[model samples]
Target: MSKSAVPVNLTDRLSQFSELWSQKKVAVLNDYEVKLAKLKGEFVWHTHEDTDELFLVISGRLTIQLRDADVVLEPGELFVVPRGVEHCPVAHEETAILLFEPEGTLNTGDAGGPMTKVAETLR
Candidate 1:
């Protein structure tokens, strides 16, 4: 198989795979997959059993709702949801993001909604 590009145009990279929840392979490292995700609305409130996930906002805005607070993220800012914390992510408008997580992370760790990506596939 060929390698995906490392330096990518965020807009174009995300356009290549226009699917919610499913992560497209932009580039890969031994422990992480560089992903571009376009999201809107809300996601299920979930938690990872033992792995933390990092969410980087490349465009637009995102809100991470935890038990006690909501953390807002804007372009160029990133947020990390520690393992075992039940949280839900919401986007009021169209959002583009880059996420870094361990190789096998259930996108919706707990209360997964309709857009949850159950299986990890490198597209």
Candidate 2:
């Protein structure tokens, strides 16, 4: 057993931040990072050419709009956007989500802008 093996309480971690669209790193697995974010409004259309992105809705609703269609997710639902697929996430109200992606994966992906942010580790 190790300190890292301690169970993480997602709700407690989520309460530590309030910035919309900003991701907070909660844990890590292999070369991946498990992140949490509070989202609202529309996000920039982007693509992660190297790896897929996973989004799990913890609360409220989220819509992942792809070039061909829109994938809507509600609480307890998850969606994966494959690599190289351009997508935008929109949430009509405040939505809490869990994201699993490779370490160093940028939030904005290829559409870097002011909205882009480095996922900060939660303390």
Candidate 3:
């Protein structure tokens, strides 16, 4: 089997955009999508009832606030929020993160407010 020649540079792709809370698609694996997002402040409380959401911090810090406790992650760390669990992500400073989830997973999940965004492919 032959391997694909191109490699994705996370930093280079991240530099293409500057919008906070918006996800940019970098690649897809089977039915899932690999996305990069810049985050700051607090996101709306939401729950993905069908699939788990993975968050990998590429830079700065992040706090995944749950109903009972908060899970903090620094650079190079990751966390997965299980399905049906309510979660809110907070970042005091500008944070860069990679998200792995099923294709078409909404950024706002069930919240569906103004902050919701469609993950546009990074070209």
Candidate 4:
């Protein structure tokens, strides 16, 4: 669903989840999708060879652990991990994030594993 006809209140959607490392699709726009995820602890190291991944911290904090450095983000901050760059996302505590990526972009990227999900709509 597109938010063009209605406002998507992220805070409301986020309240419905408590699972860590799971992404829930909220809306779709053209070829991209807007998703929300609840995270805690550390995520697997992965990379999307075909598409850059966008991460927007909605609440709490997150750190994108790249091979060379760690990129930390606070609420309202956003970052795009370039395609093909190996990276891991770790959350010290419960964190909420919003992601904008191509429709079929894998959550685990090219490093698909058990954590990899067939991204689905939550509502």
Candidate 5:
């Protein structure tokens, strides 16, 4: 297929990675990157001080737990977590999500730990 005509399938891209909480870049648009993450259990309570994070559920259910409330998301639903707002993501089962954020935004945010990853594209 022509490089520009190639299709990026969420289900297909999701099959490339199994590690929870780690993200794989699927596309780039100007200064932003499109990422896919497989989430299970609870993620670190973190805040992206420099950029807002957009989370779009592709399959299964996802809950964004904030200090004030929990935002529940299902397939095709999206929520944007504003910059610097501390939050955590929890998935009781394997959940797939699409994220849109500025390039270089770390997966672990300011709560960096072993989960911090050097961002790279998967396809």
Candidate 6:
């Protein structure tokens, strides 16, 4: 990717990013990739077999909806959805979110639920 293709600051990039559910990749590890996203409304219920997903709320409020439980996150708050567990997401107010998960982790989880986005890399 070109110099222009990279974001000067991932935090700064949050404002112009999509308010809907989507992943804008930032960095990576041997088995994981980090992404930043803006979330609002409800997402689909889904799960991942081999990878657990981490969620950190940078700003605003976010809610993780699971089959048996739900977690509400305020700014600076975080939660994890374990591997093979099903969960959905919802945000009453627009929220900035960060995630760390395996490289090929499916956004909609294993079944390709409705919240899935065609993930993208920053550089």
Q: Per-candidate TM vs. native?
A: 0.83, 0.97, 0.96, 0.93, 0.94, 0.85
The window of 10 residues in a row where model 4 has the poorest summed lDDT is: 1-10
Task: Rank all candidate structures by their TM-score, best first, as comma-separated numbers.
Answer: 2, 3, 5, 4, 6, 1
Candidate 1 residue-wise lDDT, 1-123, digit = tens: 334444556677676766665666565678777777878888888899888888999888999999999999999999999989989889998888888877766687766666666434444
Residue-level lDDT of model 3, residues 4-122, one tens digit each, is 55888999999999999999999999999999999999999999999999999999999999999999999999999999999999999999999999999999999998999999999
In terms of lDDT, the poorest run of 10 residues in model 5 is 114-123
User: What ranges in model 4 sit over 4 Å off?
Assistant: 1-4
lDDT of each: 0.78, 0.97, 0.97, 0.91, 0.92, 0.82
RMSD of 3: 1.7
Deviation in Å, model 3, residue 107 alpha carbon? 0.6
Question: Per-prediction count of colliding residue pairs?
Answer: 1, 0, 0, 0, 0, 0
Residue-wise lDDT of candidate 5 within 1-123, one digit each (tens)? 779788889888899889888889999999999999999999899999999999999999999999999999999999999999999999999999999999899888998998788766897
Model 4 gets an lDDT of 0.91
Residue runs of model 5 more than 4 Å from their true location after superposition: none
Q: After superposition, how far is residue 27 of candidate 5 from its true place, in Å?
A: 0.3
> Clashing residue pairs, candidate 5?
none
Distance from true location, Cα of 105 in model 3, Å: 0.4
Query: By TM-score, is 4 or 5 better?
Result: 5
Give the range of the ten consecutive residues with the poorest summed lDDT in model 1.
1-10
Better of 3 and 4 by TM-score: 3
